[model samples]
Target: MIHPLNFDSLLFGYPVGKINVDQSWDEQGFLEEAKTFQLVYIFSQSELKYSSETVRLVDIKATFFKRLDQSADGCSSLERPNGELDQRLVKLAFESGAYSRFKVDERLDNEEFEKLYRLWIQKAWENREILSLPEKEGMVTVSIDGDSGKIGLLAVHPDSRGKGWGKKLVKAAEMQAKREGAQGLYIPTQLDNLPACHLYQSTGYTLSQKEYIYHYWRN
Candidate 1:
């Protein structure tokens, strides 16, 4: 069932309504506002990931479809890595030794890989609006399951816990998936992750199935 949220007014009709951005954001207020709109912004980074540019999270923002109708422009509010604002941050991540752990190809020699990577990043930014947080960051990739819809991996940093960040991330993913006509969203976690299990259940998701794995170690 769709969660309850507040509605300002219906412009076109039901399922094509607007959110009252000026409305207050108390827990109850947000819940009431959320019921009216199919899409809701859970949490945003406020600051552009790469720049000091600031946008008020509470500002009246239109749905992607509505905005597209008005502008018919390819340019997006999304901050892709190519733009001047994002390039700096991308450079920093590459220079810092952090990308090494992920084994990201530092050598940007492959034009095809770069193109695919940019598209992947754009899709991910499009999927998750809250890219500012260091903890519970997620990446989107094509599914090996050979599906049309994308698969997401939300990884929570070891230091971050008890904050419900991962749950918020999953909610974002579900919204994106629904928007993209996905059957459902799936996440895989180890059996030992009790906290993760609770988080998933709290957000109205259940364990659909489990996988068994055998690891062979060499001494």
Candidate 2:
């Protein structure tokens, strides 16, 4: 069945919908239904065979998780942003989403991709949940729900890639999560994004889940 995505439709200024299908789904019928929306997101546990019109946006979505049994290091160096959002932070946010499906789908305008990340950072900052490491090298946004915590966005500037800022920001997020009484933290990234996957793996996070994501754009 197809479900309309209200927020996504509003954000992109067009009709958007999503379909969660299993291996037994009807491909021809799915395509017919997909054509009703401007954009349709297809999610599946295993890959699905589709016509050329459907684009495989993410081959694998890898999610990592780390328990918060022990206190995390590198918290001292992280600072919460005050007042206006830093332009550098906005740049970092945009860089963090370079591998996102929004950027990968050529159908979406480049300006919309930038606007999406920009507003993401702005909302995180306004909520005062953003943590920035020293010198604006990297930043992470952490949020808590019940006993779980999530890393909303984590980014390290391209110029500071090799300096271990990404790991530090991750540690800072963990520390923040522990302080908020969360039992564990979850971070999700595209499997094709090797650098992010490596960073999370090297920082004590283990692979928790994997799924396939596809996009069907109405012509």
Candidate 3:
């Protein structure tokens, strides 16, 4: 079945929908149903070999999870911003999504991607939930629900790539989650983004699951 994605439609100025189907789904039937929407996103547990019409956007999304040490103290170096959003943070947020499906789909307008990330950083900052290094060279956002936590957006400046800022940001997120009484934290990155995968693995996160994401555009 196809579900209309109202937010996506509004963001992209076109009809957008999503389909959640297993490997057993009939390809012809799925394509026929998907044609109703201008763009349809299909998510599956296993990689799907589809006709040329369907574009495999993200090969594998590897989600890494780590159990927090509630006894450990949270990081004190990260600070929450006050007042207007920082343009630097906006750029960092955009950099963080370089491997996102939106960026991978060449059909999508590049300006839209920038606008999307701009709004993302703006909202995260306005919500006052964003954390950043004292130097403001990187930032990370975390969302908590009961005993669980998830890192939303993480990015380090291009000039500071190899300086271990990303790892520090991850550690800060863990500490923030622990302070909020979260027992564990989860973060997802595209499998092809080896740098991110390596960073998470080195920071004590383990692979939790892998999924396939495909984009079907009906022009």
Candidate 4:
């Protein structure tokens, strides 16, 4: 059934929608539908594998979490940030490592991307736990699905990259999950984001799975 896909699309109208399926999904059926709809996302997932890799859980009293400041984030992205769409973040997502695997036409333009981010941002805030590290100059959003803590968004300023802010926020997310009593934390990223993937591994996130994200557009 396409029920899962429908739910994701309804939540935020993300120009590109994503759905995760394990080995049990109808592979041949999906391929057949791919011929009818535009397959915009594709990736694979794996169980997180690691040994004795523990992240240093640290939370400073000086650090705190707050609501998202769309205005501030928009300014960082550009002068006029669209209130309707989180376009600023969408543009940065363009640099994603997995994007190279996509067909050019499958990608959404800025306007459409903004709609997607807008929907995701709203949902992340409404249902998930979202945090911003002002001290470290970064942002991260997380959600708990079943026993896992899922990180929805993680971003740091370009100027803040090498200073360990990314890892800090990642560690913070881990701590957040622990406080909520999750068994483990799950973070998804593309291959092109070597730095991010490395940060996760170093911070103790094992390679759980690498999957393809394929999107279908009915037009």
Query: Residue 15 lDDT in model 1?
Result: 34
Stretches of model 1 off by over 4 angstroms after superposition: 1-151, 157-160
The worst-scoring run of ten residues by lDDT in candidate 3 lies at 50-59
Q: Between 1 and 2, whose TM-score is larger?
A: 2
lDDT of candidates 1 onward, in order: 0.35, 0.85, 0.84, 0.48
lDDT by residue for model 2 over 1-219, one digit each (tens)?
889999888888888899988989688888777777988888898888876656565547899999988747666888998878899999989888988888888887736688788889999999888999778888999999999999988988788789878887888888888888889999989999999999999988999999898888776
For candidate 1, report its TM-score.
Answer: 0.36
Is 1 or 2 the stronger prediction by lDDT?
2
What shift in Å separates residue 180 of candidate 3 from its native position after superposition?
A: 0.9
| Candidate maximizing lDDT | 2
The residue-by-residue lDDT of candidate 4 on 63-181, one tens digit each, is: 12222221211212112122343544443333331223332333433344445555566666555365655342566776876666777667776766687667766766666666566
Model 1: worst 10 consecutive residues (lDDT sum): 60-69
Candidate 2 structure, TM-score to reference:
0.94
Give lDDT: candidate 1, residue 186.
Answer: 60
Total clashes in model 1, counting residue pairs 3 or more apart in sequence or in different chains? 8
Local accuracy of candidate 1 as per-residue lDDT tens digits, 13-55: 2331222222232444444544545333333212212111111
Which regions of candidate 2 are displaced past 4 Å?
Answer: none
